[model samples]
Target chain A: MRIAVDAMGGDYAPAQIVLGAVEAVRKYKCDIVLVGDEEKIKAELAKTGMANNPHLIIHHASEAIEMGEHPVEAIRHKKDASLVVATKLVKSGDCDGVLSAGSTGAATVAAKMFLKMIKGIDRPSIATPLPTTHGIALLLDSGAIVDSKPRDLTEMAMMGSIFSKYVYGIDNPKVGLLNIGEEETKGNKKVQATYPMLKQAKDVNFIGNIEGRDIPSGKADVVICDGFVGNIVLKFAEGLAVTLFQLIKDAIKNGGILAKLGAVLVMPALKKLGRRLDVSEYGGAPLLGVNGCCIICHGSSNAKAICSAIGVAIECVKNDVTGHIRDSIAEEELLANDSETI
Target chain B: MRIAVDAMGGDYAPAQIVLGAVEAVRKYKCDIVLVGDEEKIKAELAKTGMANNPHLIIHHASEAIEMGEHPVEAIRHKKDASLVVATKLVKSGDCDGVLSAGSTGAATVAAKMFLKMIKGIDRPSIATPLPTTHGIALLLDSGAIVDSKPRDLTEMAMMGSIFSKYVYGIDNPKVGLLNIGEEETKGNKKVQATYPMLKQAKDVNFIGNIEGRDIPSGKADVVICDGFVGNIVLKFAEGLAVTLFQLIKDAIKNGGILAKLGAVLVMPALKKLGRRLDVSEYGGAPLLGVNGCCIICHGSSNAKAICSAIGVAIECVKNDVTGHIRDSIAEEELLANDSETI
Candidate 1:
C-alpha cells in the first residue's frame, strides 16, 4: 500500500515528515510519496540515509500553504501546495491514503476538494483518539463541521464507531453523545434532538448520554459531538494536562534533597505515566467520513508522532476503515431516516 | 449582614452546614439564619457549640428538596423546603443573602421564584470560581440556563464581571466569551451572536474571545458562556484534574522504593498544588444576576467549602454585586439594542 505525506506541513516539516515517512516505510512496509519540493525532500531523505530507498518516492509540489492562511482560499488558489497535491494523489488512486500535520482547516479543505466524500456521507469528521483510564476513546468532529445538526451528530456516531472498531479493534465500541447531563433529556437543542436518534440506532452501542466528567473515566469508546465543542474539549484537556504536569515538576524540583531522591525513585513510573497519557503513540487524529483515509497530526508533532500518523494512514488503508464507515452508513440507512425528522 | 444558610442541603447536611455557618459567623462577624428543620439544625449547631450563639438564629423550614427530585416540581410543592424558605428570607429583607448546597436546579428555581430578577436583567447565571495559573477565574452560567440565548450570555458577562470585581477584588476584570477559537467569527450560533454584544459592551472590560485552553492559563478573569457549555467545561476540568492526580499517585505508589521516596519528598509541594487547585477554599459557585446574593455550594461540600460559600455571600452583598450588575445592564441596555439585528 502507498501513502502520501505532506512534507511541507508541521513545525518540523520536511525533516520530521521525511524521517517519519522513512520510519513508517521500514516498519509498516508501506511505500510513501513525499509530496513537497523535491530538492528539500531528497536532502532530508539523504540525511536520514534513505535517499536510494525504493519504497520512498518524491513528488514535487511548487506551492506551500502558510499556517495562518485561510484554508478555503489556500486550497483553491494554491493548487500545487503540498497538502493539495497529497489529497489529489489519493483521489487519483496513486496513493491509498494521505497524512498531514498541517493546518487542520487547510487539510480539511484540500481533502474535501480533491478526495471528496464517501458515499451517503453528508459531512466528514475528525476522529481524535483521547487516552482514558481504561483505554482510548475516539472523540469525533474535533475540528470539522462547526455547527452540526442532530442528524450530522448521528452520522458522526456511526462513523466514529465504525472507525473505532477497525482502528482500535473494539468489537462493539460503545457510542455516546456529549451532553451536559447523563439523562437523555438534558443538553442543548441539537443534543436533545440527537439523543433519541442515537438511542434508537440499532447499530450503535448506545450508552445514553455521557457527561464531560465521564470522558476521562472512559465511559464510552466513541464520544461524538460537533467540531466546535470537540475542539474546545481537546484543547482544554491538553492545556490542563500541561499545567498540572508543570505544577508537579515545579513541586518536585523545589522539594529539596528528600524530594529530589523521591523524584529519582519515581522517574521510571513518571515516564510510564507520561507514556500512558500519550495517546499519539496510537496515531494522530484521523479525519473520518472523507473518501480516503486521511490522518492529521499536531503541528508540533515530532518524528515519532509523524511516524505513528503514517502508521494510522497505513492501517486505515489496509483495513479499509473509510470503506467500513461507508458500508455502515449504507447498511444502517440511518442518515435517510434521520433526515426525515430534520 | 445576616445570610440565610440552607441547613438541610448538600451531602454533609446539617453537620457541615452548621459547622460552616458557625465558622463564618465567628470569622466575618456576620449573623447567619439557618433555614431548615429547626430541631435538626439546632442539634448540629449545639455539637459545634454555637447552638445559642447570639449571631446564630434557626429559621424553621418544614420540608427539604431531595437531590434527585425534579427541581421545579419540588420548589412548587415543597413550599417549606429549606432552599425556598432561605430565598424567601432574602426576599422578605430578613437576610442579606442565602447559600444552599442542595440540588443546583432546586436552588435556581427557588432563587428565581422568591428573589426574582433585578431590573433590566434577562436571566440569572451561576458563577463558578475556577483555579488558574495566575489566580481564580470566574466562570459563569455553570449550571443555570441550559439553553441560553445570545442576550442571556450578554447578561451573564455583565453579571459575572460585576461579581468578579467584588468577590475577587479585581479592579476591572477582563470579560471574555468562551469560544472554540480566539477569532471573533469562531464559535457556535450563540457564541457568534454574543461576541459582538460583549465587544460593544463599553461598560464591560471585553476581551473578545477565549478558547477553553485559555481558561486554565488565566487568559481572562471572567470567562463567560452559556450555562450548558459552562457546566461541561467545569466538569471536564474537574474530571481531568482528578484523573491526572490519580495517575500521578498511582505512578508514585507503584514505582518501587525510589519512586515512593520521590513521592515523599514531593508531599509538601503536592499539598500546596492541591491547595492551589482547590477552588472551594475561595467559595462555592454563586448564582449571579439574581435579585439578591445567592451562593450555591457543591453537594459534597465540607465545612470549609461551605464557609467559603458563605464568605462569597457576604462579600457580594457588601459590595452590592447584584446592584452593580443591575447598573451595568441598565448602563448598556445592550440586549434591548442588540435584539434589533437578531
Candidate 2:
C-alpha cells in the first residue's frame, strides 16, 4: 500500500520527513510518496543518500501552511500545499492513507473538506494511544470538536473501541467516559447525559466513567470525552511528563559531583525511560470517523516520529480500521432500531 | 490566629492529624484547637510528646465522618462529627480557619453551610496551587462547581488573581482562561462567552486563552476555568507525575548493577525532586469566596500534608484574603455601575 507524507509540515520538515520516508520505504515494504517543495525535498534526500530509493516518489507542492494561519482558510487558499495535496491524494484513492506533522486544525480541515466524514458520522475525532499501566488506552477527540453533545461523545466511544480493536489488536476493548468522578452523575451536564447513551451502546463494551487519575493505570481501553476536556487532559499529560523529566535532569545537574556521576551511570536507563514516554515514540494520533485513514503527528516531530507516524498509517490501512468503524456504527444502529441515533 | 483541626479526619486519623497540628502550632506560631474524640486525640498527642504545649487545645466530639459516606448526608446526620465541629468553630468565630484532610465533598458542604459565601458571590471556588516552571500557578474551582456559566468563570479569574497575590505573593498575577487554543474564539461556548467578561474585568490581568500544554511551563499565574475542566487538569497532572516517577523508579530497579548503583548515589536528589512534585507538599486547596478561610486537604493526606494544610490556613489568616475578596468584589461592582451584579 502507498502512503502520502507531508514532507514540509513539522518543525523538522524536509530533512527529517524525507529521511523518515526513505527509512520506511527501505525498512517496511511500503511505497512512500513524499509531498513538499520539489527542490528542497530533493536536496534533503540527496544529502541523506536516499534519492535513489526506487520505492520512493516525490509529489511536489509550491506552498506550505504556516502553523499560526487559520486552518480552513489556509487549506482553501493553499490548495497545492503539502498537507492539502497529500489529503487530496488519499481522497482520490491515489494513496491508501495520509500522514502529516503540521497544524492539527489545518489537518482536520483538510481531511474533512477533502476526504469528508464517513457515513453516519457527525464529526471526525482524533484518537491517540495513551500508555498506561495495564497497557495502552485510546483517548479520543483530543481537539477536533471543541463543543460536543452527549450523543457525540457516545459516537466517539463506539469509534474509539473499534479503532483500538482493529488497529491495536485489543479484543472487546472497554470504553469509558473521562470525568471528575466515576459515578454516573458526577460530572457536568453533558457528561451526565452521555453516561446513559454510552452505557446503552451495543458494539462498545461500555465500562462507565473513568477519572483522570485512573488514566495512567489504563482503567479503560477507550477513554472518550468531548474535545475540550479531552484536549486539555492530553496536553496536560504531555506537559507534566516533560516537566517531571526536566526536573529530574535539573536535579542531577544541580546536585554537584555525586549527583552528576549518578546521572551519568544511569544515563542509559533514563534515556530508555524518556524514549518510552516520548509522544513521538507512540506514532501519530488517528483522525477517526473519517472516510479515509489520516494520522496527525506533532508539529515539532523528528525523523523517528515521522517514521513511526508512517508505520501507524500502514497499520490503519492493513487493519481496515475505517471499515471496522463503519461496520460497528451500522451494527449499533441496527441493534438500537434508530437511524438518527448517532 | 487559632485554626481548628479535624483531628479524626484523613487516612491516619487522630495520629497524623494530631502530630501535624502540633507541628503547625510550633512551627508556624499559630494556636491549634484539635476537634475530635477528645480521649483519642489526647492519646495520639501523648505519642508526639507535645501534649503539654500551652497553644494546643482539644474540643470534644463523639462521632466522625467516614470518607465513603455521602458528604451532605454525613454532615446532616453527624452533628458533632470532627469535621462538622471544626467547621462550627470557624462559623462561631471561635477559630480563624478550619483544616481538614477528609472527604472533599464533606468539607465543601460544611464550609458552604457554616462559613457561608461572601456577599455578592454566587458560588465559592476551590483554588489549588499547581507546579509550574515559574513556581506555582493558582487553578480555581478544582472540583467545586461542576457546571458553571461565563460569569462564574470570570469571577473565578478575579478571585484567583487576588488569591495568588495574597497567598503566593504574586504581583498582578497574569490570568488566563484555559481553552483548546490561544485564539480569541478557540474553545467551547463557555470559554467563548467567558473571554469577553475576563477581558472586561478590571480586577485581573487577563492574558487571554492558554492551551493545556502551556500549564506546566507556568504560562500564567492564574489559570481560570470551570470546575469540570479544572478538575480534569488537576487529576491529569497528578496522575502523570506519579506515573512518570514510578516508571523511573522501576527502570532504576531493573536496570542491572550500574543502574542500581546510580539510583543509590542519586537517591537523595531523586527523593528531593519527587518531594517537590508531590501534591501533598502544596497543602490543601482553599475554597475561595467563602466568608472565612477553609482549606480542603486531600483524603489520603499524611502528617506532612496535614501540617502544610494548617500552614495554608495561617497564610490565609495573615493575608486577610477573605476580607480582601469582599472589598475587591465591592470595588468591581461600583466600577461596573451595577450594584445588583454578583
Candidate 3:
C-alpha cells in the first residue's frame, strides 16, 4: 500500500517530513509519495541517504498553505498545495491514505474537499486517542465541525466506536456521551437532546453520560461531544499538562542540592512517564468519516511524531476503517427502516 | 464578619466543617455559625477542643441533601437542609456569607433560590480561581448556567472582572471570552455571537477571544464561558492532574532501587509541587452575580480545604464583592442609557 505525505506541512516541514517518510518506507515496507516542491524535497531526501530508495517517491506540488491561512480559502485557492495534492492522491486511489502534520483546519478542509465524506456521514470528525491509566480512550469531534446536531452526535458515536474497534482494537467499545454529569438528563440542551439518540443507537455500546473527569479514567472506550466542547477539553488538557510539568521542573530546580541529586537519579523514570503522556507518541488523530484515510498530526510535531503518524495511517488503511464505517451506516439505515415500518 | 458553614455538607461533613470553622474563627478572628443537625455539629466541634469558643455558634437544621439527589428537587424539598439554612443565614443578614462543600448543583440551586441574582445580572455564575504558573486565573460560569445567551456572557465578564479586582486584588484584570480560537469569528455559534457583545460591554477589559490553551498560561485574568464548557475544563484539569501525579508515583515505584531512593530525596520538592497544584489550597470558588457571598467548595474537601474556603468567604465578605457588583450594574445601566442617547 502507498501513502501520501504532506512534505511541506508542520513546523519542521520538508526536512523532518522527508526523514520520517524514509523511515516509514523502510520500517513499514509501504511506498510513500512525498508531495511538495521538487527541489526542497530532493535536498531533504539526500540528507536521509535514501534518495535512490525505490520504495520512496516524490510527487511535486507548486504551492504550500501557510499555517495561518484560512482553511477553506487556502484549499480552494492553492489547488496544487502539498496537502491538497497528498489528499488528491488518496482520492484517486493511487494512495490508500494521506498524512499531514499541519494546520488542522487546512488538513480537514483539504480532506473534505478532495476525499469527500463517506456516504451517510453528514460531517467529518477528528477522533483523537487520549492516554488513560488503563489504556487509550478516543475523543471524537475534537475540533472538526461545531454546533453539531443530535443526529450528528449519534453519527460521531457510531464512527468513533468503529474507529476504536478496528484501529485501536477495543472490543465492544463503550461509547459515552461527554456531558457535565453521569445522568442522561445532564449537560447543555444540545447534549441532553443527543443522549436518547445515542442510547437508541445500534451496534454501539452506549454507556450513558461521562463527565470530563471520566475522560482520563478510561471509563469509556469512546467519548462523543460537539467539536466545540471536545476541542476545548483536548487543548485544556494539553495546556494543563504543560503547566504541571513546568511546575515540577521549577520545584526541583529551586529545591536546593538534594532535589537536584534526586532529579539526576530519577531522570530515566521521569522520561518514561513523559513518553506515556506525550501526544506525539500515540501518533496523529484520524479525521474520521472521510472517504479515505486521513491522519492529522499536531503542527509542532517532530520527525518521531510524523513517523508515528505514518504507522497510524497504515493501521487505518489495513483495517479498512472507512469500509467498516460505510457498512455500519448502511446497517443503521436498514435498522431505521425496520423500526419505521413497525 | 460572621460566616455560615454547611456542617452537614461534603464527604467529610461535620467533622471537617466544624474543625475548619473553629480554625477560621481563631485565625481570621471572625464568627462562624455551623448549620447542621445539632447533635452532629456538637459532636464534631467537641473534637476540636474549642467546642465552646465564643466566636463559634451552631444553628440546628433538620435535613441534609445527599450528593446523588437531583439538585433542584433536593433544594426545593429540603427547606431545612444545612445548605439551605446556611444560605438563609446570609439572606437574613445574620451571616455575612455562606460556604458549602456539598453537591455543586445543590449549592448553586440553594444560593440562587435564597440569595437570588444581583440586579442587571441575567444568571449567577461560579467564578473559580485556577492555579497558574505565575499566579491565579479566574474561570467563571463554571457549571452554574448552561446555554448562556450573549448578554449572559457579557454579564459573566463584568461580574468576573469585579470579583477578580476586589477579591483577588488583580487590578484592571484582563477579561476574555473562552472560545475555541483566538479569532473573533471562531468557536460555535453561541461563542461567536457572544464575541461582539463582549467587545461592546462596559467596565470590562474585554481582551477578545482566548483558547483553552491560554487558560493555564494565565494570558487572561478572567476566562468567561458558558457553565457547561467552564465546568468541563475545570473537571478535566483536575482529573488530568490526578492521573499525571499517579503516573509519576507508579513510575518511581516500578523503577529499580535507585529510582526509589531518588523518590525519597525528592519527596519534599514533589510535595511542594503537589501543594501548588492542589485546588483545595486556593480556597473555594465564589458564586458570583448572587445577591450575597456564596463560596462553593469541592464535595470531597477535608479540614484544610474547608478552612481555605472559609478564608475565601471572609475575603469576599470583607471586600464586599456583592455590593461592588451592585454598583457596577448600576453604572452599566447609566452607560447603556447614555449610549442610547448618543
TM of each candidate vs. truth: 0.96, 0.97, 0.98
- For model 1, the docking class works out as medium
User: Residues A194-286, candidate 1, lDDT per residue (tens digit)?
Assistant: 998888875689998988898998999999888888888898888787777777788777777777676677689889989988866877999
In Å, residue B155's CA in model 1 sits off its true spot by 1.6
Candidate 3 lDDT by residue in tens digits, A1-342: 999999999999988888888888888999999999999999999888899998889999999999889999999999999999999999998999999988999999888888889888899999998999988999998999899999899999999998899988989999988888888778889998999888889878998998888888889999998899999898888887777678888899899899989988888998998888787888899998889999999888888888889999999999999999999999888888998999
Ranking by DockQ: 3, 2, 1
Candidate 3 local distance difference test against the native: 0.89
Best by lDDT: 3
lDDT of 3 at A317: 92
List where candidate 3 sits over 4 angstroms from the true fold.
Answer: none
User: Candidates 2 and 3: which is better by lDDT?
Assistant: 3
Local accuracy of candidate 2 as per-residue lDDT tens digits, A162-227: 788887889999888999988787898999999888877878799888888878878889999889
Q: Tens digit of lDDT per residue, candidate 1, span B242-264?
A: 88778888888788887787677
Candidate 2 local lDDT, B267-315, one digit each (tens): 8897887777677788889999889999998877888888998988999
Clashes of 3: 0
Off by over 4 Å in 2: A338-342, B338-342
* Ranking of all predicted structures according to TM-score, beginning with the best and ending with the worst: 3, 2, 1
